[model samples]
Target: MANQASIETRDVRLWYGEFQALKGIDLDVSRGRITGLIGPSGCGKTTLLRCFNRINERYDYVRTEGSLIIDGHNIYAPDVDLIELRKRVGMVFQRPNPLPISIRDNVLYGYRLHTPKAERSRGAEDEALESALKSVQLWDILKDRLGDRATRLQLEQQQKLCIARLLPLKPSIILMDEPCSALDPDATAKVEELIRQIAGEFTILIVTHNMAQARRVSDECVFMLIGEIVEHGRTEDLFIAPKDQRTADYIEGRFG
Candidate 1:
């Protein structure tokens, strides 16, 4: 079967006040695969990632134009529910920002919010917690320390916990913005491996300044410059033989 697009954008544009951050971007992010967005700082990669969940709207002056569809739904449709949309599209930030609550609580936070108290049972909650942690490869290490504060965990584990928290919500797509930027080389590699392991189950769009990390973890790559996508192709093709001179220059380290 042909691969399906999990998210599709047609002439998507964003403006923060008078500054246009994204300029008529059209791209299709494949389902069950990892798509990497790479560019220098302020290139709008992160802004595009935030658009998937409508998080950019948090800014009062921000305005978006064009269509952004996720899993066949036009996210900007007037009837769409923001809460439900966020539940379907989760985001992980650059640094590990676990709440000071217990590890188990952190993992179950979204689950509890989306699910009513009457619908939640002890066994179901336990199962959900274990399943989420296991999916992120954190179950074995933190199983016995579920009551410990999440912020006290190591940076890598805290980051993984942030990802685990999202799984219970069963998000259709996960947006990661510079997810490993705050980690060391070793921690970054670990997180990258975890990301690869989870790719087939969920559509992932990750923004990373580290080109090597993008090549290692993503199935396809999108290169952007000055608020627009310059080139996008399979990871190997985009890196080895870019169709655009600008893409070749960026990949070859001529300029960011």
Candidate 2:
């Protein structure tokens, strides 16, 4: 079946000075579906994720060769506006790194990043912030005490706040790098539920080490080895009956 591509990587290659990180990788991300990137450490999952935001381009030694298209625009092109690109493709990291400010402050950070000081309105900002918290199911828990320190919230609440923080921008896609890695089981479940609720609203690409998590949340799965993709297919087919020996071995827990 042909999936509508929300993001695509065509003959993409990455290098850190002379050392190559990604080897002519080709990737297709389905619109409004979850795509899981599973591979051992340093196999380039995070590197590839960073590419979506042109985060790789910021590093001095890093150089990219090929096309990364998002919503039909060649993002790797010379004139792509990186600031705007990031606003459209938001990211959540492995750790829940909330700001040292109030919960409301954390959620408004992205708005501040994209909106100019001259154009930003206090009322508009508040409305956007509240809407974001609601989207992540965090508004009720945080609504009463918007002025309290962000860290005062429970760890789970804080993580959701971090997610809430990003949602205000209404990004078309979200890149999650091991988002539930640091949470307890209950917190993890909450995060997983949030994923299900938000998947259809935003195109999501996740990098996870947990095989079960991949099977649980992903619509499509990509398995990589030594910086090269060994297999890519529908999550059910890949997990139930992977065609490649390496993919089968990795998923079977013989190797990562």
Candidate 3:
């Protein structure tokens, strides 16, 4: 399949109060691929990831300039619907945050919210729940435990559940902010495997501090510094032979 852009940004800049978090970011994230954003702390990796769904605008003083286009629609347009935009672009946080409700409920929460009540029959809900859990390799383990509270699962399971929930919504893009930061080595490996398995099905944009993980999971990598992109290219090219000195230094551990 030909690689197409799932997301496009032109001169995208964001500010919180008086502090500029992202400065003139222009990027094209390809469809059905994993693009990793890597940089030192406070480099605005998380801020740029949040811009896809306009989550930063939640704060009253937050301001954004320039256009952020997703799936041919400019999300910053006045007539855009925030609720629908979020459904198309899902997010996984640094930590697993599941609802206090049953596992079944958590999986169906977004589906129920976005889907019309008249079309949500018991059979359809069951199908969606099972499909989502199976996609994340949780169906065999959690199918019997669907009645249990979601928060009662293991940390790794919780994070996988978070990803599964998004699948039911059929999101075109999924943004992950350090999704494996909370897991142990073994759990991280399992989660990374899951990410790889789902790569060609959805466009994934991940912000990660783990260079090894970025190299392992991403097809393309983007390195940022102080709210600006320094380099972006194929993962191997960026790591083995970077085009920019800043990228080389960071990859070589000379400096963050």
Most lDDT-accurate candidate: 1
> Can you write out model 1's per-residue Cα lDDT over 167-205, one digit (the tens) per residue?
999998999999999999999999999999988889999
Reference-based lDDT, each prediction = 0.95, 0.89, 0.94
What lDDT is obtained when candidate 2 is compared to the true structure? 0.89
How do the predictions measure up, each by TM-score? Answer: 0.98, 0.94, 0.98
Candidate 2, pairs of clashing residues: none
CA shift of 64, model 1, Å: 0.3
lDDT of 3 by residue, 115-173 (tens): 99888899999999999999999999998889999999999999999999999999999
Count of clashing residue pairs in every prediction: 0, 0, 0
Ranked by lDDT, the better of candidates 2 and 3 is: 3
Please, what are the lDDT tens digits per residue for candidate 2 over residues 1-256?
A: 2366999898889999999999988988999999999988888988999999988777799999989899999998889988889899988889888999988889998888888899899999989987898888988777889999998888888888887887878898999999999999889889988988889889999999999999998999999887788899999999999999989988999976
Residue pairs in candidate 3 whose N, alpha carbon or C atoms collide under 3 angstroms = none
Candidates sorted by lDDT, descending order? 1, 3, 2
